[model samples]
Target: MYTRILVPVDHSDTSAAALAEAIRLANEQHAIVRLVHVIDLAQFAWSANEFLDVPQLQSSLRESGEKLLTERVQQVQEGGISVESELLEIWGGQIARTLVDDAVKWKAHLLVMGTHGYGGLTHMLLGSVAEGVMRHTHIPVLLVKATESK
Candidate 1:
């Protein structure tokens, strides 16, 4: 049984679905769930125009990530699950690597995450973090694909 469950989430239906699954598993195993939200300030800030304020954009991203983590933590708590959360802000780093590192650092028994399940051209353009985690991590991972209605 998974005594420590790690769940990485974002502001997406896929992520929400993954959190739901994590909560269920945590309840079943009487485990503690650690929710993580990663914000890549470098990628997001550089994607904007030169006229945009980089510092301001980074701050906003951090705030947004914190809000998302707070909300998700509340949701998990409401489910009567033992939960904690972390908002990771990276300048320019691999998200999957960060997740894996966190999972290892936390001694998580299982890492649960969501996937959009994009294929072909879309997947090539938007690289899959879940796939990367699956390929790189030695820890067990649970991938929850977003449903159409979600």
Candidate 2:
């Protein structure tokens, strides 16, 4: 009986698939969908050091994040589903925590996300965001894995 669904989309194929699934489920139950995109500030911060100036770099990154979210929101709205979208530009270090916090704040009954699998050294080096969200959030999570590139 999920009435409020939170779909965290990153414009990835897996996320798109999850959004489609969420749309179907929402339509069946007449539920509200909240689309969220988290802009990892930490990643931006790190990249800022490589740029000419921190302020300029951060500004560019923020603008890009906003544009990306807006486009995705428009796409979702076109599907004839009632939707609310949020763009959370949080410091990169606390992405997992911030996502859980937002989910609770939104009072989401379920969270749908896409997972890009990491293996070997990569997996160990960059931990799993989906796993972190699953471990921390009280709401149920539906993870859709990306299809292998042919």
Indicate which candidate wins on lDDT: 1
RMSD to native for every prediction?
Answer: 1.5, 2.1
Cα lDDT for residue 34, candidate 1? 97
- Per residue, candidate 2 scores C-alpha lDDT tens digits across 12-101 of 788887888888888887888998877765665565386557677767777876787787777767777789888887775567777889
Worst 10-residue lDDT window for candidate 1 reads: 41-50
**Lowest-lDDT window of 10 residues in candidate 2?**
39-48
lDDT tens readout by residue for model 1, 78-140: 989999999987779999999999999999999999999999999999999999899889999
Candidate 1 ranges with C-alpha deviation above 4 Å: 44-49
TM-score computed on alpha carbons, candidate 1: 0.94
lDDT of each: 0.92, 0.80
TM-scores of the models, in the order given: 0.94, 0.86
